[model samples]
Target: MFDNLVADFERPCALDIKLCRYYHGQCEDEHKRKKLEQKSNNSTSLSLGFRICGMQVYHPETGKLEKYNKYFGMSINDNQAVEVLRTFFGNSSNTNLHNISNTVRNIHTAILNQTDFVFLSISLFFFYDCKKTDVTPSIQKTDIDDQNVQAGFKVRLIDFEKAIASSDNKIHQLPQRIKDNINYGMVNLANIIDSFVIEK
Candidate 1:
């Protein structure tokens, strides 16, 4: 029973970004691990610490919704990740930028505070309203809302089936490599978002 995150938006643009450079778990079968590694290496996940798993954005100019599949995500290189994010956030207005920046900052803070769990194969899901009226030409930095769903933009971390918690007695301690991978992903994502906001 999961709640619809984008139910409130009229025209919601959604993006699924898979975090961490590694996707395989230590306990997985050797064959499956290799397959996951190959998939990660073939996508932006290997080089960028993140990959666009999927996206659906409403293009106002075309009055049509554009859907990007996992194949499109896997084909893109590190150099193209920024442009892909730009498309997701939309270049026509600053509203999305403001909201996304705030969301990223919140995610960063949450990541910093998280110490007992190591998330594996998780994704950051971003959604924002794409209606023309939702676009705001200018917004003061001070007016940027701190809430996750401010201005109809929101981001949430999902896909936690592989997450390892320190409280699990079977796993006496979480491995450092797992922790490092998540930190690496978050840091790289923050840098990417920072660059995108700065460029806009």
Candidate 2:
């Protein structure tokens, strides 16, 4: 199902590399398409390709294939992904509701816009600095502007063995099956976001 989503979103000409080349003819459908890709060489958009179901199609932007490095996608489904996120964020104060909602909405929007490849499973990474509770002397006012504290979030879609190539169509309505799965995934995600409670 995820494969179908990705196929619908990505243009054949957009992917940076035809990851099928790495399969050495072992991959079924995706591998066959590599032949068609050979006829054209205009695609240059850097793409991570697909990696689910133990199948890997990795293409680094640096043009160096790092087979040794771990690929990012985890094998969890939508429900599990939501659970993991809830556990990480723990409980939040009502004041943080807006931020939590915005985070979910942003994720949903990004997924909807990504028509290139279906993501079998998605992974979330939370990065933040340790809270500095110890009181420190405040430096006197200076001309230098300080960089904001660093905490970032990222989403990774993995798994593409079932991926199929399709045309990109942002304006057109998707088939019912695809729409159903997307809606289901979003609902689960929303439930997780709603679970956050304002810490008293």
User: Which stretches of candidate 1 lie above 4 Å from their native place?
Assistant: 92-99, 135-146, 169-175
Best by lDDT: 1
Off by over 4 Å in 2: 1-87, 114-120, 130-165, 168-182, 198-200
Q: Candidate 1's residue-wise lDDT over 30-136, tens digit each? A: 88788877888788787888888899999877869888888888888887777887777654344556556656666666756778865665678877777737444
Residues 111-185 of candidate 2 have per-residue lDDT tens digits of 566676543223322222113222222322222111111121112223334343345353134444433233344
Q: What is the Cα-based TM-score of model 2? A: 0.35
- For all candidates in order, the CA lDDT equals 0.69, 0.32
Counted clashes in each candidate structure: 0, 16
